[model samples]
Target: MKKGIDWRYRISNKEAMMGVVLAILNFIWWYAFAYGLGSRPVKDYTYILGFPAWFFYSCILGFIVFTILVWIMVKYFFTEVPFDVDEYKKEETE
Candidate 1:
């Protein structure tokens, strides 16, 4: 019935794409550090803060990094979307 895309749809699509991109980046970060350092022999592994280097970089530090990334994304990239269906309907009928 509508002739063009709605603003809500545009915002939703953008947010969804950003979420997917963040997930992919997080996975890549985890995979690279986990496999790159963990593939070596246990005895040859390095340590950081009493944890294996791979674990430290891939898990502990990753958690911190992604937490900050998510915060920044929400604060800057994400927008506040109204959920008032009645208001939208009223606007459409105007």
Candidate 2:
């Protein structure tokens, strides 16, 4: 039932920008923790929650950060489709 005019709302600039920005942010976060913290001496490193500093920051903390960032972007950047979406659906018999 998709209509011709529905394409206008398919993908907004804000949503696309959020995707790209989040992707870059995720890469930098993981890279920094993996390489930045990982480059330091192992003997001098500290443990967090029974895990090494690098692993804890890169894996555990990174996962949490990613989740939060995604949630934030989805909540703020994405546009909510209007409830009257049926207006965009065209009747094929017409």
Candidate 3:
């Protein structure tokens, strides 16, 4: 440990778990609209301009929603914790 110097900012395992969960959620969400829902109701959905509901628009919207969720989690829960360098040093010395 050094005075006026902080050794921190280690990535949390919980963050990794969260990322995995989000990825899975994205996969499920996208898959539901793309395939799970099948090829019927999606085709019936009215288009705004010309593109169909099952086109790139849905994909983009899903990505935007996913991004917002991840951003919220990062902004709220992500944090830096101080690491004990001396503890590691002592273990290495042993």
TM-score of each model, paired residue for residue: 0.89, 0.70, 0.62
Report the lDDT tens digits of candidate 2 across residue range 1-94. Answer: 2656455455665577779888898889888988888898889788998898888998899999899988987887677654455654543235
For model 3, the superposed segments whose C-alpha errors exceed 4 Å read: 1-11, 41-45, 81-94
Per-model CA lDDT versus the true structure: 0.92, 0.78, 0.70
TM-score of 1: 0.89
**Whose lDDT is higher: candidate 2's or candidate 3's?**
2
* Candidate 3, pairs of clashing residues: none
| Residue-level lDDT tens digits of model 3 in 8-91 | 433566778888999999888888766633466755665645655554445867889999999998899777553678874665
Candidate 1 C-alpha lDDT tens digits along 1-94: 3666567888989999999999999999999999999999999999999999999999999999999999999999999877698877787789
Better of 1 and 3 by lDDT: 1
Clashing pairs in 2: none
Could you tally the backbone clashes for each prediction?
0, 0, 0
| Candidate 1 global Cα RMSD | 2.1
